[model samples]
Target: MGGSPAHLDSPMVDGYGKLQTNGLRFHKRLTKNPCLLDCAQTKEYMLHVFRDCWRARTIWERLVDQDKWVGFSQGSSENWFLRNLEADFNSQGVTRWRLLFGVTVWQLLRRRIDRCFNTEVFGRDPVGVILDYVLEVELAFLNNKNLGRDST
Candidate 1:
């Protein structure tokens, strides 16, 4: 139940926080910018990208179903993220969930960047691209954490 919010160090989360508050240097706001996401459900917005985007929702769904962590699917504000970080769960579970949250945000932003600059990396199914990134992040996290723990 006690862990630092170190997972929030992700650059994507920082940029997304800025995006939500009109602090980023985007050429246009969500109201004016073209929604370049594969979902293309609507104009791009912070809440939409993190909480309501169809593709984002899909990722959350998979996390909930597979990891049994339902908290990721909740809340819509920047404050919601802070609350999630402060949520009461067992220490190891809390760390894992926080890491998952950060990884999810990072992958979401990476997907958008890939669409903008490296369309071929996205291939046809963008959801698949996201799933692959999530798997890689989770595996890397497990390896890193295991390396840090003493076997004795």
Candidate 2:
């Protein structure tokens, strides 16, 4: 019953955390700005990075109804995933469709951060990002399955 949080272990978490942390540090070093350090340190926390951040809020709103995704507002990321994902997995099955949803969330978060921090882009296109990640994950799963079979 215990495993990493579905959304937390996603590629987006590692990629986004690295980008945010490094961007924070780079901003601090280049500008000699203490305010950048403050923003970076504050953003390192998960709730602030994922739930409360303005960019993340926009993505979350688009992908899920407020009532569905708002559990994270009350609890830790682990709690949110465990409670909600379990319900989703039960209903949807543990197939790629269910797992990819989690991956989509993670990827969208990373895309949102990239669009905001690395580019002049301001809009949050969560649906497009989610679709892209879902297709990528699905392709990876299929490739892995194909590789596992015998050549004969």
Candidate 3:
């Protein structure tokens, strides 16, 4: 939404399988539940982590609150993930949503790692930390684009 869509080559972007399953296994080995965030009620799978986890759900709801076109909880969680991936490229918010979606997944995955391997580094507020990181990266991206244009 902010810049011409550029290809993201990292596994974090193109490797849905890796992101989803790795977190599942990593957290599973740690807590016997695949969920990155422990809600203490039920075992978490990929969909729950991204869509139903109270923390993640709140983040997504806030992200799309003003947009009428999309709501994260409107339909099947699996369908939601698949549809967003294949959404019409020309749609107004699809690009932006895709970017945000990827960032959220990446951050969630990172949080999972920290929770398991570096407990001291995992913050008390994971959604907040993730949002801060995403915003910081977005700002850097915008600044780099501006510098490129100025140089050209």
Cα lDDT of all candidates, in order? 0.56, 0.53, 0.57
Model 1, span 1-152: residue lDDT tens: 76436544533344333543223323444223454446645455676766677767766665544443555456667776786566532223333556566666777766655555454564455445545655677788798889889564
For model 3, name the residue pairs that clash: none
What digit string (tens of lDDT, one per residue) describes model 2 on residues 37-129?
224353355555555566555655565544555443457767755655654422222245356447655664565556444655536565565
- Residue-pair clashes per candidate, as listed? 0, 0, 0
TM-score of 3: 0.54
The ten-residue window of minimal lDDT in model 3 covers 8-17
> By lDDT, highest first, what's the ranking?
3, 1, 2
Residue range 95-142, candidate 3, lDDT tens digits: 355666677776765665555555566436655665566677778889
Comparing 1 with 3 on TM-score, the higher-scoring candidate is: 3
Q: What is the TM-score of each candidate against the true structure?
A: 0.53, 0.51, 0.54
Residue 52 accuracy (lDDT) in model 1: 75
TM match of model 2 to true structure: 0.51
Question: For model 3, what is the C-alpha lDDT against the true structure?
Answer: 0.57
